[model samples]
Target: METPASTATAETPRPVDRADRIRSIDVIRGVALLGILMMNIPYFGLPEGILGSLKFDHPGDANYLTHQVIEILFSGKMRALFSMLFGAGVILLTTRKEHSAGLSIADIYYRRILWMVLFGVIDAYVLLWTGDILYAYGLCGLFLFPFRKLAPRYLLLASLVCFGMLIFKGHLRFQDMRGKREAYLKVVALEKQKKKLTDKQKDDKKAWETVVKNGKPDQKKINDEIKNVRSGYPTVWAYYLPINTKIQSSVMYEVYFWDVIGMMFLGMALYKLGVFTGRLRRRGYLAMLLIGYGIGIPLGWWVHQETTLAHGDFGRYLDSHFLPPNRMTYDIRRVTMALGHVGLIMIIYKSGWLRWLTGALAAVGQMAFSNYVMQTLICTFIFFGYGLGNFGRLTYYQLFYVVAGVWAFQLVFSSLWLRFFYFGPLEWAWRSLTYWKRQPFRISQPDSETVVSSIQA
Candidate 1:
């Protein structure tokens, strides 16, 4: 009789080979991974307090313009694309497993995601990056398995529902903030007369004051945060951990969960509809590109214009975010921009003119897991206190120099690394842990099939 080890080997599901990888998905993933850095770099290099506020730059400044470009073109769009790609990966993985005779899908699936959760914790805490999305992705991924087999239409419906929930939640939060602001103003008017304040009135006044302070951050707070971020590792952790905790807890559930899940469902729907597989006609992609940008760009511009008009007015800034038009259209702008980006990328892929560029992008996408982590490591060393300590030193446009440097390095490194190795280091490790076995590491001389697989991907 065969031993238990042999039986387990025979039953265990294996990772997909390079030959089976979808080039379009890989290209998309690569683009999304790189685009994410455009937004994340500011947080890494600047004091957190100054972000999304007019504290750092006057209106119409070059720095402000740089921010506007990124805010409109990339910002949430990249992350949305990332979330959708993850959703597509779910479908891709399970669909492949359907033919894996004797394999336990749930056993493999849950184990994979659980390990991702562990990795996410490591990415956030150990790596000291508060903006890590792996944890949120892993958390959202748990619910995706059950919905894998749903039809495209049903998936689309579910996605819409999730997006709708986010809008509803935004409205409710806006109402609460508006009420507090009104109360605070009323208390202020009363105080002008030197009248006694009720306890509730005092509390209301305090709450709105706190909001104002956060929204229109003081220069001293920014300076102090800069100093803290430029300190040693322990000081950095202590200063930032509460931020991490709050983001991982309340913010994750309230905002990221719905945002991520909605994109995920949309991704699954698009995958079933062949959006990422080059199955959609060229004209179809063109329409998506046109329509997506047509709707999203103007809306994003309007929102940004209105918000920027607030300048130093805390209440007006709050109104911009939580009030009509801007509040309601946030999801629409992000989603449509994300889809528009996809269309543009897909059009490029299908055109097949820039083989050299697309090939490099595909390689980067293949090792996106590694590249993402590498970005964290490289950036922390470049900006954190213990390393070069360039935190808060770079201006907005100047930050992109760092981004470009990183992009060049990753593109080259990912392309070169794959030539010698079958998988990226982290990808290899993740696969090993998920399957509970060591996996092949180095690439051998390629056969015809391997070459074909490489070309196809």
Candidate 2:
């Protein structure tokens, strides 16, 4: 028998070998990584302030059609899917470590998340992508390490609670908007009658004015933003820093933290149920596809249409009672759409008829971290002032061309890169940081090029 110390040394945990990766999960992750760009490109290529305006394009325009298709099919769906995958990843990492009887799980866990936090900062400040999700995910992941072992039911219950909180918060916002609109109307009536306004009423009128100003696109504001985005690197950094800080701080907690943690909990529960592992039957997946799409598509369409109509008038958009489905069904539609995607991807994976497509996607998924960062680099280069300076120039529909080009490049590059290497450049770096040692970066085996092919098989 070996000594305990020797046994510990022999059993040191390492990154999962490529052969052990679940192909379906990788494929789904790749789909999400690629699909997210469809939504993110608007932020990368347009004035941020105008993003909230529903009337970005007139009816029958290319932009309007593109917006409709994306909103109905892929709005929040990709983020939800990505969040679930991250949650599943937590289970995958901890379970493997536990089975191997390696070092303390918390030690490795926190170290990994902390490093991710650092990366998120770099992605935001250095890479100049303010919409980075890693920082928020890292923050939420801190609270997730302890709950890994919870039963699926309890984990789901926790997820539902988080989602419920989000819904309640959305309702409160709607009510607040209603209150502000009411106050503004009251103040307007008093002013028309030449009566004195109360202090509260004056404040409310001011608040409503602020809302309308922000919601309606001001050409001067848009011009200023475009000019700022087209300036040199230092100016660009200064312009975006506070915005990045706010997103990473308050907006992160108030908006994204709950969304991420809830999906994470749900993902963890699904993993425990073996859903991510392709253990769910074909009929079950079919049912998910049908029910999820059936519910999500209609709801999303209705919400989008209402939003389009309401946003045509800034005042109408701010009137809470104008649209019933706006924020109320947000979670329901996104979650269901994501479920539909999961089922659809699972069916394709199990069917094995789309090996060519799935094979490429799996390769992309395998290196998702590197690819995600790569996108930020590429988009910034194309649109930021220091690079191509195309910011605020592309029409809304034209943004997809950039997205498509990036998708093609990443699919091919990631597939080819992985044939000779065990990990993507960033993934290797991240693993090295997490394990406190440099990992083997290249594949030594003669058959390494066939790794993705095996998944296709």
Candidate 3:
């Protein structure tokens, strides 16, 4: 009879070969990172909600076209791709360690997540970008470790369940909004008729009024917000700091947690299915592109048009509500577009037609953490009062010029930095802190061969 350890060894699947880094994953990650910057640039250069409010009054205007294109192509898709990649990274790290060391790496992984959370807090609070996703990513990562061993089918099913829950919650919220609007209208009617309102009715009317004011802010209020953000650093910081705290707590944990975790689970399932490893057939990839784009692009375009026609009014009613269609179909559009992107990137990688560009992208992916932070630093310097103080100045189309410049810089800098160093600056620090051992930084001549092979693999 075999010993229990031997029996368990036979039963469990062997660890995957992680010695050779997957070049395709890195390339796709790089693409996702670049796409994310495209979406973030608007937020960086303009006041919050300005892009959403900018009316495309004329169809021929460049700004209107730019807004439409960004909404259709980039909005949630890049973030979804990034979240999925994070899930794939979790499996890759934990399984590789288990395979090589013959033991669980839970303790070290937890430490890594803790550090990531710390970094996220710093990024959000210190750097002052209220739109930071790192904090949410860090928090969600803590919940992912236990599910590492789940089967791919179960993982996908769980993801769908999570998504369903989000959709259900959204429906409930929409209904609640409708009820409030009806109640508020009744109160207005009573006031017009010179009838008295009960104390409870008065309170309900006040609450609904506040909601309406916030959802559809007046033009003067929008201009004031723009002026405030365009003012000095102290003024802008004071205005946004409290808002950031609320967003970091409620929005991050409440509204976005489901979306992030659902994509992560999908990512893990895809990874297990060999989708990210270039193992899927060309026909399968082609099908993903066809079905994904066929459904996602047109639906996204419809939402964009609907939202634009509403002039960005965010009311409760379907006809009057700003971007209601977009809100309703957000997950479906983003996920399908993300799948389409993955299929496109995989095809490009397999063809070996753009090795130079892919290689550069892989470098950027390798140092994603560093590049992400660097983007915040650079953009804040450009737009914030302490730096160039150009906030609320650039138009939607002009923002793309800044994005293109940053992309060029990051591509060149990442490729150059990796040529000499073993890891990106932040990645090195993160690894050292997690492992409690200082990792090697400078690449020795002998190590150069390994680094090149890893990059090219």
What are the per-residue Cα lDDT tens digits for candidate 3 across 117-200? 899888877887878888888889999999999999999998998788788778777667777777888899999999999998
Model 1: ten consecutive residues of lowest lDDT: 95-104
Residue pairs with clashing backbones, model 2 = none
Please give the lDDT score at residue 219 for candidate 3.
71
Question: For residues 1-457, could you state the per-residue lDDT of candidate 1 as single tens digits?
Answer: 9998776656654556676789889999999999999989998998866676632357678778888888888889999999999999889878763223443777768888998888889888889999999999999999999999999999999999999999899889878988898899899999999999999999999999897777765799899988988999999888889988999999998999999999999999999999999899999999999999999998898877776665557587665454655668888999899989989999999998787778778888998889999999999999999889999898777889999999999888887777667888999998888777787787678766655455345
Residue-wise lDDT of candidate 2 within 1-457, one digit each (tens)? 8998877655665557556788788999999999989889999999966765533447767888889899989988998999999999999888763223555778788889999999999999999998899998899999999999999999999999999888888878777877788889989999999999889888988999998777777989899989999988998899999999999988887789889999999999998998878999998889889999999999888888788877777567666464356677888898889989999999988987778888889988989999999999999999999999999888788899999999999988887887777788999999888877787788777384466553342
Error of 3 at 421 (Å): 1.2
Error of model 3, residue 311, in angstroms: 3.6
Which residue pairs in model 1 clash with each other?
none
C-alpha lDDT score of every prediction, in listed order: 0.85, 0.85, 0.81
Better of 2 and 3 by lDDT: 2
Candidate 1 TM-score versus the reference: 0.92
lDDT of 3 at 132: 86
